[model samples]
Target: MPQHTPDHPTRQILTLDTGVDAVEPGPDQRWSTWPSIAKGQRGPHPHPDWVVTAAAALDTELGVLKTGKEADVFLVERAVPDDPDRAVLLAAKRYRDTDHRQFHRAGTYTEGRRERRSRDQRATQDRHSAWGRSVRATQWADAEFATLCALWEAGAPVPYPVQIDGTELLLEFVGHVDDAGAAVAAPRLAQTRPDTDLLADWFEQVRSAMGVLARLGWAHGDLSPYNVLADGERLVVIDLPQVVDLVANPFGAELLHRDCRNMGAWFAARGLEVDVDALFAEVFAQAW
Candidate 1:
């Protein structure tokens, strides 16, 4: 029989008979009651510390953050045992159930992406097969993780990708903790209505961020206010699994044009005099 710990109500502790050794949970175990968060990591950037290491440990699931047609985003917390300060909260996006995903749009979005193997390419195309579903899940996860890293390094407003495990992706959480110790995700730009000054400032940030992407010869395939999170004075872009390649994909130019129009219209609707043509021209000039 197992008993619950007082501090960790959800954890169960098992006691063995006398003269027998008790087996405690190790780093490899992902127990429901394990404490998340480590020590000495109270810095601004709280990314995962163990990505390429085999000595990495399992993390605790906090809760589900959001759901989409292709994936469900959950909150995960990982920390070194007995070290609370080094703990970090991450957005764990799990890609599952390809049948429920809107993969019909995959062909157009993945035009520029190169598959490492023919099997994977075949599997991705055949979404009805088991191997196909598995490959699609991993492919999307890998694409999102890679895009996040690239955009972050390129100084674009996006989340920092920490690690990718099969169909799951660990990314930086783009929200702040409230005064009551509750985690609050930053509202999407669509959910916000800023004043004149703040709105103008936000537009500038959005334009600059988009410029960064254009300079990298990429375009967010799905650019809208709903996927952009407003974190105080900054804007963090999300959902990059469908990022477009400006050179390889024939529809790349169209995607960039659409993105510029979408964002420009958004700002214009708010009474901001934004030049969509100029923005598109600038991006096109920078694209190779």
Candidate 2:
């Protein structure tokens, strides 16, 4: 998610990759919109140490199920801390080493959630310096961790954060014992339709996940194709690194609503129809 610079780097690839649906890169340069905001995270490398620690904790484990952002996910069998014989398959999320420049503008999502009145006050101030960046990076990782834990507690469809072992975080793996290798590429509500009953069940999971978010007063800010993995019976949401601010993110409702819409569209593609507007209306009805 690089910034919307005219010629910095990935801009060319994105232009070539998604020319039609692409929102023309803005020229404001004030760090107000998506590209400028996304620019802070310019690489796939983990911009935080927690991510690296997360990876190191799960490396070289047999049967590691891979799926995630910032950190690589592995499905590994390890003995439970309390019971040595009770080995379990855990999905280990490890953060890769990402540069600090990737998070200079992240204050926009965090500050708004804690502020009293204004959001622009601390949106993108001088936080890219040595000390400021270090603090901001921690805040960024913590925020994502909060959302992941929140989703886990709310019974949303995602892996639970088992333990934050320094940089490595562990959770119950999604696939079953036999189907571990069947897990395909990241699957979002935007892609794939297995069958009627299966697609219907997935719709329920997606909707139910959104319901959990609304009940908890949060949004899956980064809901999209790249953040999901389709294992036989479930739609597991990944990528929590950039989940938006429920308050400051001008697109919170729209983001959540679009999540519902995306799921609805996916269902429709599979001959299952749903009223996208009604779904959105119902989920955020209490909020508005």
Candidate 3:
């Protein structure tokens, strides 16, 4: 047992054996030695090349960002040691604990989707089988990853999907660092109160993003202000695990209408002049 200091009695102090005399270390010396990423040089839209290389060298888990019924998001720091420019903050979305997830509604969203192998499809259908459970979980993850890649390629304002490892997804963090040097999460649009002009701007931004989805013949099945992030002046759309193919799904039109209504209601509540039916009509006009 070591002697405890009266001033800081609760903290454990270790006496390290070095070639020189033992000394009381600085406060920060006891903390992690990994270099903090001062700032990333990847810019607003990081290229796929950089995201891939950086994610391969992820070092630490900062903490949990948010919790949801389907998945939990964590803040992760990835870096190449000794290089600040190559480091970045990433959102690690882990789709875990299928027992707690709302997978019962899976059938509705997966109506138009299919498995390439008949055996795999059968396995997914059999809820009693272990293989079936595994397939169902993997299916959810795969769907989101595919949707992210598709939307990103189409030039939508979305988090850059870095990589996917089984049920885990690594994506671009949507917010900036605070004055205290801690990472600050982007608030959901539901939590923000922008002025009249900024409110209109936000509506336009989200409307444009919704237009991109409409043009692709896709509907964000669970679209709502709660899932959309407000990063300063920009609105980044997220939570795409239930994306629907407008041309293939029977309930696609209803889903699209609901999305427009959800967003329109939020803007309208904030005194923004927006018509839900008009927005839906404009979006559908560009559909395939």
Candidate 4:
């Protein structure tokens, strides 16, 4: 007989007894969603070694890591039963459906973006419809996932996008395990109090990351210290659903300037002697 879980409405789990007893999933766990979604929904080719693709794996919801205007991030652990070595933690960022999301400035960020299908375009405009809300939710998730994939491939310091199912995006957890064996999320760059040498190193990493985006003709539309994670000495830029195409978006240059100013001011406040104008000029030059 097959058993159904409330969380996963699409799949049915069959608890078949084969000489060895089947391990029934616990209340907080469900079968890994890898085999259910199409391969195209998965991460880029040559998947990272830590990504568990086994059908037998279970995904356990750990807890909420963050909440924002558009989405909420939760900690998830995926592992095969009885295989401790195959376990890995992932940050599951689930974009809220239209009804729940409070992103009032979406239009500002999506100025030059277009829906591929005419129907989708129409639905996105008709926010009152259920279909419209669903489309809007997935749009942000898809955008962020695609952006992370591109940035990671271009050698930027960003989390590896694992996969996206509907509006939920799974990414490589950019944190370390604590002494108690519990995963501790990396502190945001704004929360860190780095010394002189470390501050300079952090600034250099941010400069290099911004350079990469410039080369790609894109800008982290709302970049700030709050959205960057400080994992040891490495800085990982996040919350990139609003990445602007330098040549396409009307406010691209303005957004780029703001990004430079935002990060520059933070560094300067710490006595780093950052020149916002020079930083913007250096990045803007590479955009061409």
* Clash totals in order: 7, 17, 0, 0
What C-alpha lDDT values do all the predictions have? 0.70, 0.51, 0.73, 0.84
Write one digit per residue (lDDT tens) for candidate 1, span 1-288. Answer: 753211201111111111211134443335322223232211123323422122333465667899987899997665544444345566778886666775568778889788889888878778488988788777887788777766765657777666666677777777766666566788989889988999999988887777778788888878999889988767888998999998899998898889989988888998899888898888777765
TM-score of candidate 2 to 2 decimals: 0.61
Task: Candidate 3: list runs displaced more than 4 Å.
Answer: 1-56
lDDT of 3: 0.73
Instruction: Output the better candidate (2/4) by TM-score.
Output: 4
Error of 4 at 17 (Å): 26
CA displacement after TM-score superposition, residue 192 of candidate 2 (Å): 4.3
lDDT of 3 by residue, 55-111 (tens): 233345668999987889997765544455555667888896567785567777777
Which candidate number maximizes lDDT?
4
**Candidate 4 deviant stretches above 4 angstroms:** 1-22
Residue-by-residue lDDT tens digits, candidate 2, 180-241: 43323344445565778887777787777677777776667656644666865667887676
| Candidate 3 all-Cα RMSD | 13.2
User: Can you tell me which runs of candidate 2 are displaced by over 4 Å?
Assistant: 1-69, 80-84, 97-111, 115-128, 179-192
Name model 1 segments beyond 4 Å from true: 1-58
User: What TM-score do all the candidates reach, one by one?
Assistant: 0.79, 0.61, 0.81, 0.91
Find the candidate with the highest TM-score and give its number. 4
Q: Which ten residues in a row are the worst by lDDT in model 1?
A: 8-17
